[model samples]
Target: MSHPPMRRPPIFPITEAQLVSLFMQSFAFGVHALVFAVCMHRWFCRFQIAGLGTKSWPWMVVATSLFILGGVDVSLNLYDNIIAFVFFKRPGGADLQFETISNWINIVRSVLYFLVAMLSDAALIYRCWIVYAHWKPRWAVIVLPTLLWLGAIVCATVDVYYVSTLHKLATIPHEKTLRPYLFATYLMSLLLNFLVTGLIVYRMRALSKQTSSFIRQQRWNRLKTVSRIFMESALMYTLSVVISAVMEMISNDAFYGTTDVSVELAGIAFDLIIIRLWTENTREESRTITESFIMEPPPARPRLNSLGHYQLRFPPPPSRVSFAHSERGSVHTNISKVRRI
Candidate 1:
């Protein structure tokens, strides 16, 4: 009798969702690289212009950390993808690999994301504090956001603990033990963003109103522009988090894509604020130099009168005063004074 034909081993196929996630991640990585390059260039330019004495060291540190972590996170992700798709000889394919929640790569990626979120939130909170530094009871203004940030830290810690302890075959989007903490972490971050953004916008509007009568129209416009930039950046970051949170809730593979994008978006958002402010400051300095050259009165010189005696000349009286707000929220008044002869 002829022997039964040998049965082929079953092949596990990757799903459309996984493919979509991979594509989106690749796209996001490319975009993130471009944005990161631009941001770094801007940051270096600012560093050169301002030197080491500026108060921007904290931001520089945060930006650098994000860049390094982002690179590592993406590198690990690519390695995981390669191992799963190219070299793995397992019966189950990439789908099983991607679904494994307790994988070391997955856990490390999650931790990197948590760190990014925390850094971004902390930077936003610091910005809020700087903006309200002049207010009475300044600490009171940031109390809520600070507490929420702490709560996020706790939730993330718990979630990571649970994730690390999961079984080898455990799947994501179905881990009940980790779900609540994950939800809480994202929710806390979302709420913190909203509250901080609102406080900052409110403070800016108040400053605008209080200075409306005395502040020049040009200065007022600049303040408004800064406020708008702050709002737009915050909104971009907030929307990214919102999308990622929604995807996570629905157990969509897009959550991986969006979450990765959000990590880069956080740095991008923070960098945008600094870039805009630095650009504006550069432009303002150039304009001021040009105006000084054009509008500066000639120096008073001693001249001989008809009486054959030297007479003293006096410069014109001061006509206007300008108020400039420093990065630290201090207001400076610049007044032109007549020279005494």
Candidate 2:
């Protein structure tokens, strides 16, 4: 008689899943580092060209903080993995180490993740505000998103408190008390990102329409290009949060992997916008220079007159017209006639 296959031990999946998460986290960290480097290079180039300013300082600080926090978070994850796989000499193996709710490294990683999410969301809101700054009631546009961000802050604080208070070694699935706060935090962030991104995109589209009549077709195309970039970057972070929230709700071990990726992706999303904008600005400047050179007028050639002397012919000056708008909204046009001697 054929024997039934032996069942796998509970520890098998825990160890395997954690290992997968560790590998994925490391790979993402590599990408994050490379992006961070490029971002810094672009920022420095901009600084050199434009010189130091208050507005530029804030962006540099934010990008640097995000990179530092991401690095620390990934390092803590690495330490936890090493402890679970190599140093922990216990009967339960890696599962015991991973399931320990009170692990210090795990607690720190959770806090870092929450911090990064908040920072990224705040940056998105700032971008939205900047885009709408010219509107009469600009603040009204971001009120809802700002409120959602505050709610997220409260949820994240509570979640961190709960995680810190857990004294026992237990599986995450069994922690019913913490699920609501965690879910709320992720849900709020998801909504905030959606709203902010939508608002920015709508504003861009509106501007495109408003300027279509007066602006060059090339400029309209540039606006579309910018809108596309913003959407692509925002979508990257939004999808990561969506996957994370879904995984967290289901209590899947894969949540660890996705959450790890989300941390790096948050920074990547923010930095990507700056990098792409800088590139676009550079391309536009180059194109402008090329057009100026191509459209430049040719030098006037010297002509030999009947007196055998070289003479240069100059073009006649054009008349000028100026428009003035009165307080009552009436426009007055004045034409200046050019007189030739």
Best by lDDT: 2
Task: List runs of model 1 lying over 4 Å from the truth.
Answer: 1-19, 47-53, 168-170, 298-318, 322-341
Over 193-295, each residue of candidate 1 has an lDDT whose tens digit, in order, gives 9999888778766666655666567655666777788899899989988898787687555677788778777877877777777676667668778977877
Error of 1 at 89 (Å): 0.8
TM-score versus the correct structure, for each prediction: 0.83, 0.85
Cα lDDT listed for each candidate: 0.73, 0.77
What lDDT tens digits, residue by residue, belong to model 2 across residues 1-341?
A: 99999965553365776788788888988998999899889777766654433346676688888989989988888888899999999898888899887678778888999999999888888877777755669799999999999999999898878887887766554478788998899889988988888887787777667656644577556667777888999899889888977876776777788888899998888888878866777676688789767666567779999999999975544433222343311111100000000
- Top candidate, metric TM-score: 2
Query: Compared to the true structure, candidate 1 yields what TM-score?
Result: 0.83
